[model samples]
Target: MLPRLRHAAVVAALVCALCCAPAGATYSIVACDAAGDCGAAVATHNLAVGASVIYAQAKVGAVATQFETNPQYGPKGLALLARGVAPADALQRLLEEDGGFDGGDIGERQVGLVDARGRAATHTGAAAQASAWAGARSGEGFAVQGNGLASAEVLEAMAEAYRGGRGDLSERLMAALRAGQRAGGQRIGAMSAALRVATVAGGFQDIDLRVDAAADPVADLARLDDQFHAHQAMLGAERAARSGDAAAARAQRNEALRLSHQWDRIWRRAARLAMQLGEDERALEYLGVFASANPVWAREEVDDALYARLRQRPQFVRLREGLGAQEPGG
Candidate 1:
């Protein structure tokens, strides 16, 4: 009778464990191991979890709480999830508090707190599938993805990566996710991938890439991977256009447009700069190219804007007169 009761107890425990296990889900992160092309290359977007908080409070750079939620867990940043709660009382208020939730179903709560200076923190909990799920934290910022994931492992790893990650924090966070996917991500499938990398000093300003429906998460990550380089090309074009040298600006603008069709804006801006430099012929050619490549730019507003500023130039008058009369496409 005793043996039977013990066996029943063990079975019940096993069932509880299985019931509490987290379902596969999604989170955010930084960077990615994207394909070499301009497809959907990986971008940095990490979900800040735990008692940890990252901050860029001063010019000295960012700082992180470096809280280790579960010492018994794997590596320093392996598996962790942080709620508004903390391991200690005094440090509790330092975490970001978020009762609001988004994404999928709430299971394991995790966070990756990061400030402008690149600081980070992490926290986790033992609460699994209670009557309800609620989480909050302070100090560092929070990125709450409501859905519960397979385990807190990826979030914890991402936190560690963000804190100790070399180079760009966002990029390193992407690399960390890549590592997690390899370790055994959601046993099911990922519906989408989203990334958000924010910083005052970073080149790309608030660029977001989302694959709402992809057969392969990694493939989508790859697509996001290339977007970064294309983004760089766009920025470079902007810089070149701003440069005083018209020739240099043209070369950069051409390269920028080559990387992504969206960069045609930079090309138009370059054309404006060329016109300002008294390079009216070159400006007309650039504007003509911009109009041809990006029909949206061929609007009357753009034409009027440039023409309004250049009526005094002889080349401008000739260019205006020859607009519809010259060239096959232009």
Candidate 2:
């Protein structure tokens, strides 16, 4: 009898434990490192319902966010709540309580968060506007945003992206947010322009880039796409240069340099590396670009050995003579 009672007690305890657990509050956070060329950006969009989807690009430091609400919270409020707050506590405090949102149209909306821990959370609020909003935690170190999203759904997507295949946190989060947007965004079809939130290590870029509020949101977002591609070009150039493949080295270096003349430094580095690998022709091409971009620097770095190698080629000799004749003081 004692054993039977103990077993029954255990069963009851297990049931109680399961019941006591909080119903899976939908929320998530992501760990982001902006070690890439463009640094990082947090882009969010509005979705249907009183929910907002959120994502961010973290570069150099850890970032995290917790979403909670007795009711739903918009992306903006969730972002505010996520600042420097623990995931579980932040969600509980934000959601379990009442009276968080006041007179705002998005008072009762769901919210999601991303932070350094790479965990996420969600809270569904009462009925409210299917609006979108965003925020950066502080010091341009982080950013948060969302629009017309289901709190739980948004958080789920965020977790999926954070845990999904690696490469480009900002791109992953943006893709996730876009997925959420497709399901149902902001109860409207691109009523206003979209925004872009980015974090850079030493660049002048800011936390947000918003469109004119009247243009096509998708088109607006696409306009900023060039910067990301430029970044990819930079990475590809560095990789190809390292591999000592003359064709790839020349192609990537030239492409990168064409995209951003500031990348002349990268081209020069690639040129020198190409020379070391016996790809003198490719190196010379790169040197030409470098010389054209920064003549003074080129003159100082040109080596007699390099000149001798180039002189062996009639075309190179003619090119050298032409360059010398075209110089300002020559």
C-alpha lDDT values of all predictions: 0.40, 0.42
> What's the CA error at residue 223 for candidate 1, in Å?
6.2
Q: For model 1, what is the C-alpha lDDT against the true structure?
A: 0.40
User: How would you encode candidate 2's per-residue C-alpha lDDT over 1-330 as one tens digit per residue?
Assistant: 122234433543455355432221112223344342122222332221112222344332222222223233233333543465654355455443435444321133344443444344433332221223221121121223343434434534544544452545445544544544454433334423233334555344333334434334534443444344445565676677677665775576556566553545666676676676677887788778777777666665454454556656765655556455333334
Report the lDDT of model 1 for residue 134: 18
lDDT of 1 by residue, 1-330 (tens): 122234433543455466654442444432211211000112112232311222221112222221122212211121121222222221232222322223211123333332222233323322222212212222233222212344556545444544454544345545555554554444454545544443444444433445555566555654464456455655565576566555666566555555444445655665766666667776767776766666654454245655565556665555445444322235
RMSD in angstroms, all models? 11.6, 13.2
Instruction: Name the runs in model 2 displaced over 4 angstroms.
Output: 1-41, 44-85, 91-110, 115-118, 123-145, 148-162, 168-171, 174-265, 285-308, 311-329
Candidate 1: which stretches are off by over 4 Å? 1-15, 18-22, 27-107, 114-121, 124-185, 201-243, 246-255, 258-330
Model 2 clash tally?
40
